[model samples]
Target: MEKPSDNSGFVDSLEKLLQLCEELGQQIDEIGACLYPPQEISSIEAALEKIRNIIDVLRGMQWFLRLMRLGGLQGASDAFLEACNGLRSSLRELASEISSSNTADIEARVENITLTDK
Candidate 1:
């Protein structure tokens, strides 16, 4: 099995997850630029879903890290646990919003929504 990056793997995972979220945000911004109605809800939602999945993976990793840290001086810190919970809650809310959007034509709109390297 592939071992985790470090004892603080959760922190590293958080950094990676945040980077992906930022990239997704940029994609949404670009998609919003050319689309009429100025709303690419479905594309935004697909990005959000990816972010949510990353957050979920990080949550599970944090749980394992917490278990490992049980006997250490730096046991699962409140800030770390709080962040995990917040990420989970945020992802859940984003998912709910995505589910409620009446979005379609994502594939057909791909040419319009794609961002040029400018």
Candidate 2:
């Protein structure tokens, strides 16, 4: 697997990280909420363990996205795959950093979104 080019790809900001958790919920059914506050993580390490689960879910979604691409959108799918690949690597790095308590590797990269309410 290709490694992330840099360490700046991790989703920073706890709020944004929660949102990504919700996105993961799309494929796994409320898993983000289920594994977090509502479920009560026992410790920081437990939280990191949950994150590893999210990474697995995201990787699965990438395959699902690849399988769903239509022929008419071949180019679009290719580009999307690039982003998906990047996310997987990013998540992997995040898991590693959290597991080892190495905040040094942390980088919060929000999705390309602008919140008007903010």
Candidate 3:
């Protein structure tokens, strides 16, 4: 078991999560470029922007949690864990909404393009 003061694991995990958020943003951009209608693109872009904002909030929360832990605040660890879980749940739901919206159409279009280009 890792000690509470050892935050390397948490930092690494947060970094990975941030990286994944960036990748998701890029994919959204790709989908918007590929085949989404203009109106749909705007909707997707709005969601993507919200995701970017959420990522920023997550980064802020990570630093705040680290500082709180360093200050030896009571229950900081539990609070950090709870906050991380809540953010993760929010991200998951947002990702689910994005995927369910027009991802099938995007995937089908990409498949056709790939086959035709070969």
Instruction: List lDDT for all candidates, in order.
Output: 0.57, 0.47, 0.58
Work out the TM-score per prediction.
0.44, 0.35, 0.32
Pairs of residues clashing in candidate 3: none
- Residue ranges of candidate 2 with Cα displaced over 4 Å: 1-22, 25-71, 102-118
Candidate 2 backbone collisions, by pair = 12-108
Q: What local lDDT score does residue 27 receive in model 2, on the 0 to 100 scale? A: 34
Clash totals, every prediction: 0, 1, 0
Error of 2 at 7 (Å): 42
Worst 10 residues of 1 by lDDT: 109-118
Ranking of candidates on TM-score, top first: 1, 2, 3
* Number of the predicted model whose TM-score against the real structure is largest: 1
Candidate 3 deviant stretches above 4 angstroms? 1-41, 60-64, 102-118
- For model 2, residues 19-38, the per-residue Cα lDDT tens digits are 66675546334323333333
